[model samples]
Target chain A: GAGVSQSPRYKVAKRGQDVALRCDPISGHVSLFWYQQALGQGPEFLTYFQNEAQLDKSGLPSDRFFAERPEGSVSTLKIQRTQQEDSAVYLCASSLVATYNEQFFGPGTRLTVL
Target chain B: AQSVTQPDIHITVSEGASLELRCNYSYGATPYLFWYVQSPGQGLQLLLKYFSGDTLVQGIKGFEAEFKRSQSSFNLRKPSVHWSDAAEYFCAVIEYGNKLVFGAGTILRVKS
Candidate 1:
């Protein structure tokens, strides 16, 4: 793809429901990242992947949040028992082989927990 | 721990007026700073970055930012504002392993 692509641009989930968001990073990009952006706030780091290896999950807020990149190209962020506070825009980004390179971001999935 | 601060929650500027958005960061060493712009229904787009070299860096959309190490500030500026420039701006600092720590964003409103 030309850029990072995210699925379900908008999702409305009832409280306690589980939801999954997907991301397709750029071809052969070595680094991928997930972030959470609340209304009127900047994106916060959620997790990072270096190829198929999940090197950093430190930013995951709680046990309810889980992310995986099985093939190193596609990633999924799953939220269990979604709460009202979980409503936010989930963003996915990818960078070239060099970690410090500029990240290309997806349009983001707006999750609204009812 | 690395963190960024954008003091101005909202800024309004008239078209053709000069603009400046303030940002401050706290990190232990030389920081890898970045400025990004986010338009409605769009993803963040990198404006500029300060990895090393000159303190002043030019970016897309006629934007520029200066990194002042002594003050721990990386402020974004533009010589003239345009209505199309109305959007949210964010400052971020890179941590080890390419993790980015972003600040609360500043919403810019350009008046025509």
Candidate 2:
């Protein structure tokens, strides 16, 4: 793809439900990132991947949030037992490489937990 | 720990007027700074970045930002504002291992 692509542009889940969001990064990109953006706030870092290796998970908010980039290209973010506080826009970004390169973002998935 | 601060939560500017958005950062070493713009229902687009070299870096949409080491500030500016420029702007600092630490965004409202 010419740019990063994300699926399920919008999702509504009830409390205690599990939801998954997917991301397809730009071809040949070596770095991928996930972020969460709350209403009227800046995007916060969630996790990072260098190819298929999950190098950084320090920013994940809680145990309910898990992300995986199995093939180094496509990634998935799964939230278990979703809470109302989990409602936010999940963003995916990719860069040519991890160092100093500008990241390209995808139209995020807006998840509303009820 | 690296962090960014955007003091103004909202800014309103008339079309054709000059605009400036303030940003400050706290980091131990030389910081890699970036500015991004996000429109309604859209993804974030990088406006400009400051890694090294000249303090003033030019970006797309007639935007520019100056990185000052002493004050730990990287303020974004545009000579003239346009209605199309209404959007949320974010300031971020690249942390160790290429992580991005972002500040609370500043929403810009352009009046025509």
Best by lDDT: 2
Report lDDT (CA) for all predictions: 0.94, 0.95
lDDT of 1 by residue, B1-112 (tens): 8889999999999999999999999998889999999999999999999999999999999999999999999999999999999999999998884989999999999888
User: Per-residue lDDT tens digits of candidate 2, residues A63-105?
Assistant: 9999999889999999999999999999999999888778899
Tens-place lDDT per residue, model 1, A84-114, is 9999999999998747777889999999999
Residue A75 error, candidate 1, Å: 0.4
TM-scores for all candidates: the values are 0.97, 0.98
For residue B64, give model 2's deviation from the true position in Å.
0.4
Candidate 2 DockQ, CA atoms: 0.80
True contacts kept of each: 0.70, 0.80
Candidate 2's docking class is high
